[model samples]
Target: MKRQRNRGRVTLASIAAMCAVAALPGQAHAADDPAPYAFDPEAATVRGTETNAEASELKSGSVYRSAIKPGQKLYYRLNLDDDTNAYVSAVAVPPSGGKVAYGDGITVSIRDVDDTQCGSEDAIFGSGEFARPIAAYAHRVIEKGNSTCREAGEYNVLIERKSNATSSPDEWDLELRYASEPAVKAADAQETEAPENWSSASPVPPSGGQKRSGGSSFYEATGLETGEWHDTIVPGQTRFYRVPVDWGQQIFATAALSNNPKSTEYLGNALSLSLDNPVQGHVDDTTLSYSGEPASVALDPLPPVDYRNRFASASDVSAMRFAGWYYLSVTLSPEVAKSYGDEAIQLRLKVNVRNDPKASPYEGAAGIFGVSDEDKDMAKSGQSAPQAAQSDTMKLVAAAGIGAGAVLVLGLGAWTLLARRRTAPAAVPAAAGGQQPPYGGPTRTW
Candidate 1:
């Protein structure tokens, strides 16, 4: 609620995941747990909805500020060169209060300029514990695959507000982004480093940023450094943060959900934490759900980078051939949000970025949003580019792993990971002199 907004459960996949994570070296002075996250409001959003052009032409590598009215839809056209893949995303702000049905929330899809559907996907939500004042993200990818709508041309992306929305339609803010990935080199597609996934989340100096109340949107994500971060989320809501995972540094993170009986009862498998690579691809996702116990997901650290790497794998962290601002996504479904205490669910997010921070691979390139210019050129080739290669085969996909009671299921192929277990992430010792996070706030008397 502080910085712009700022801000888990486990499901069945925890059981299927092997918990053999190697312990990180013991910390001497570093706090293992994340202190409350700090907040900073950066970059005013540029609105793109003033002109409701369904075919408003958009460049392939850019982020747009846009909004939609009730039952209204906004469209942007992207011109893609043959052999290149396209990645696009839309983040929508959730209105506060009321029952939000999962089936009719947000839908994003790609089509030709004339409106023939190339491919489309709907967005879904988990239960929530509160009335809702959060945000959700929807993404779609048009790869250079041999599919129906993958060829070069002007493609339109539609951001639609379904008639099924229970709350009155308000002007919703949307952050839209699209990246064009060039083709990859044949040699790089075969070049990959498969080291044993590192398991240590050793304590370190707290990175910058003071605790912020709400970072529930792309425009409001709390800025995260190399240390652990702390925030709270209501069910049916999703919180997003921007992490500076510089090139050459490997980043490891975990989400620890409070296990109070009242909280745990409705939280079974409702927790999920995911890492989105620089281009917003859902590469590494860890999910768990349980009816009677606390839940956590230990995301293996991402390895350092090089241009010679394949972009596809069970874990997308290591698949990064280049580096920029990677987004960290945490979600608690609507069903889970409904039962969370009125105050919201408390969470300790442990993040460890090994190696020092450096400039992003795309920092000085053509773009400023971290979608590198070099990557876009390589996208034309289709194999060497990280986002482009995946574009050929996968759409911008969302991961889902739902838990029933204590049962764990690996139902979502794109969202599942071959995770080995480590102890719950909160095991880190607190930094010296730091105090437990304050749970009370200023009294509001009318």
Candidate 2:
């Protein structure tokens, strides 16, 4: 019976492939350009309301998709208990090549029924003045004897987009996430503070590793481990990758832009690399000017992940309080296209995650606060979520070809080859230069 079912699947797949190939000749090929943002396909669509009375309810441990026009204030509702720490993050993605000012960005805040603010955060375009995805999160922490925002029954999440006259008037897409972390057991709760000192030395750059494609947004970020990885980025493009950061682990990463000897034009703020914590909180970022020569940017060494880091006054220290997926965003300035052409540039990442996993003090399940074996496997596979799907699709196509006759199989093979050529990015020649040490700068410690 099992063999019969397998055979039935093969036959159906073969028929589907044949029909697809028959229509391939006249189908228009999609452009190599990716979308400005890749929202999770399974995320629920939500609409935010202007007043709290009509606000949509957001459940914990779920993802939602929404949009906000310029100068609009949207509100969403949340229900919480006194023992769990609730967090709400909003990521705003502006249109590529759109006009933006330095201060243009988004703000998020969490408030109680009495209008007492629990927490608020804002993210901006900064000096780059380029349109890109920016994330900000608001969290409600449950302290033992806190006064404000305590005993939460009903809360409101407020999101607003700040724009100026120079910015684009089009609506910006938003990705919203709500997560709750349970409190530690009473017996396990202990007072802890951020580390006062840590290593300030810059890490050595890694040489080579397997090539992987980066995703366009956090939802589709490629999974990476403690190793060297490589990718290609075109001008005006921003790529995102994620790493599983366990408790007690410290992550150090550096991004290098390969030299382009073919073009020696200088561009300021040509390369940027930014890091965000598990809760989508900004940790640290660095930028470097490019002179058509090899240049790199390295994130300052951060303290190991500790639950008590949240009590620290430093932004960077507090941002590393959670132990989950950490995000890395690398972007190239659009002005590079004017000097170096539209060809993709080589991007090499040197990532080092230190320490071992440690036990948490949560009373129950950690709930997205720690890494699992499956997360490690995904990183080792060196494929993004989308790429993994593509691989499965190709395997199914091959199986279908084998089940079909020789004539149909030959046609399918030709179609596969053509599709690859159409989708692959054009390769640029390697820069002829010796290894250059990371651009020297003041060492920072948090």
Candidate 3:
């Protein structure tokens, strides 16, 4: 192992040098499926326990059975949350109480609680599998018999019934036992992986961050009866906004209703408030949309409410309950949309698309939040703060590793020849026939 260790160090040093050189930009190509960065544990753990409420006690009809071999220990755990002497009461019944009277051919033993708070108890029944049904009360005979449930058979184990003379059964839990080789655990089952969910709405280009600009155009607010219809610029499907030459800059527009704030009802609330720009890229590019349209409406920042909007339906007052101004920011890509020859580019946004009332927590929120002053500075400077920090750490680690490798190679090369010289004299052993080899002289050894 010592020799192997030294050889491994030599090989590793060479590989480290190669890796360090590759760390330089353009020296190495990107790799697919990088090594995992951390270790995660996978084990089946009993996450505490639960019990039935007083209204629904573990009924008498509830029954469990076990098939065991001789000398095998069966463990069944019961959780008693509110009962102090619960374990003693449950252990008093015999498994075959409903069967024969004399020596029901079963044994029972109640051991101490396990280390866990759930308090597990070990009950060893008959010696062979067909050990008669030993009720909980037969624990003493089983202790004396020193036999085990050996053969395989169904032994109906029951939760103790409530006695009219004594108090009724309170809350409790039960854990059945199995004596055999551990089967394929649930943790080892195939994992269903889901792609990461909208990872914090990262900025486009993931480095330069983003810049926002706001502009306004003619917004005509129209009213209708409770169940009436209008040509309604239905900001839902697709509505266009005219941007004149003066509004030349990148345009981001939003809509809101100027109405009295209400708390609890879903009526007379804001409806489809969207804007469209022809010269801007599809607002749906980032999945930031409202009701299938390239638009969105403000959402509750705290415990958000459900919202749904259509042409002329009940208002989603949940969207407008908060007594404050709600603004929606629609990001536009001015360069791409200009290709479509339109004098005044029109952009499309959707405030509501469906009539369903299922609301999203992410709704009602305009742009993202949580950016610090430093983040803003980095964005303005066109520098990736996270990437910069990662690069610095990687460079330091790579540099230190390279330095260590160089020292190791130099030291090993110097010590290699010296070690050979020191071990040279002891390289040879007399022949197995108890005689020195005839041609043997000073041999070079390592």
Candidate 4:
């Protein structure tokens, strides 16, 4: 029979709920997902500057730096220093060579202009319609440009308030709204790739849907509380959640998470899992786990988790570049469960997460094993058992090495292409006599 497996679908709410389930009883395991918030915490830093047209020159005056990923939706808020009737337009330029990509055509008129309306508003702009005469705002998505900006480079947020008189104080402030990295593709897995191989199992024992033993409860609840969701999650911490299964019963597992509406949050990095017990598998190394511990497995580089359907693409899974609940279905063996129980077995729960503490909706790790409740209980205590010593540091080093190697490979490939182009043979021009020669230069003189 075709081996049944857990499928992955991404959802912010599901991620949160998975952590909550890990906290529930029957499996006294602690959530290890929240450790990042406690360790390296991040906060949103808002900075602003005011410019006057009299002193600000167009070249330098109309530019500022914004940290953003490609395809991220940004809402530009325009505030003109002077309220003279003017037309305002925004453009996003790549800082490398100041290459303009998007936002070039969007222009709004304070008055008289029929194209778009800004009306009698002093300042402020965006998507929401203005109740009273308010300022103007526009949203735009970043588009393809110089490759330099594709990775790390400067970008310009430009605003021009067109008025007969040039010295219109076109003060511009940007709200970097809805910024996110695009979902990395399988081909791009080596660089800035998302974890497509990683997938969440459907909530086992489907909620309110007649609970089946290890059926869908693994992903039923799809939300989580903010502030260190799991107390046990710590840096360099690794543990397993084993869900035992009956001889013929099928099961699945999924990661559960949620973000508070109060603030926007994102899940990133090499969130992964392993079968049985991986001894030396690096996130970048692709070692297909047919059986045995996770050893030197080369993982596909894919985009991090986002609130969406959680399924690693076909290529990603084929490349063995992800870690998710389905991994348990592949690695866990029924024989191993003899020590714990006799039913189903879900094994290998691992994740590396870091969150911005100030953001609402706590972040933590949770694993939902798809197995009969009785079998889950048998393996519960053992499942939560701490990973072998130094697993955290080792995993970190491995991940870093894989990243470094990928970058190196990409850089080398780029350099090789450049070198080949430079060394390629150049076309020879015909001689003045109109006859091509092996050595065209001064051939006649000889």
Best by TM-score: 2
Residues 195-274 of candidate 1: C-alpha lDDT, one tens digit per residue: 34444454453454234332444444445655546566665555666665545666677776766566446444476676
lDDT of 4 by residue, 316-369 (tens): 232122222221211121222223222322222222222221111112221121
Provide TM-scores for the models. Answer: 0.50, 0.80, 0.20, 0.17
Worst ten-residue run, lDDT, model 1? 20-29
lDDT of 3 by residue, 290-355 (tens): 221223333311111211101112222211211111222222211212232112222323222112
- lDDT, candidates in the order shown: 0.50, 0.80, 0.25, 0.25
lDDT of 2: 0.80
lDDT of candidate 2 over 247-364, digit per residue (tens): 8888999998999976888787787788987778788887878988898878888988888788889888888888888999998888888998887888999898887788876777
Off by over 4 Å in 2: 1-32, 386-446
* Candidate 1, residue 288: lDDT: 59
Where does candidate 3 stray beyond 4 Å?
1-5, 10-48, 51-293, 300-400, 415-446
lDDT of 4 at 437: 58
Model 1, residue 50: distance off in Å is 16
On the 0 to 100 scale, the lDDT of residue 4 in model 3 is 59
Native-referenced Cα lDDT, model 3: 0.25
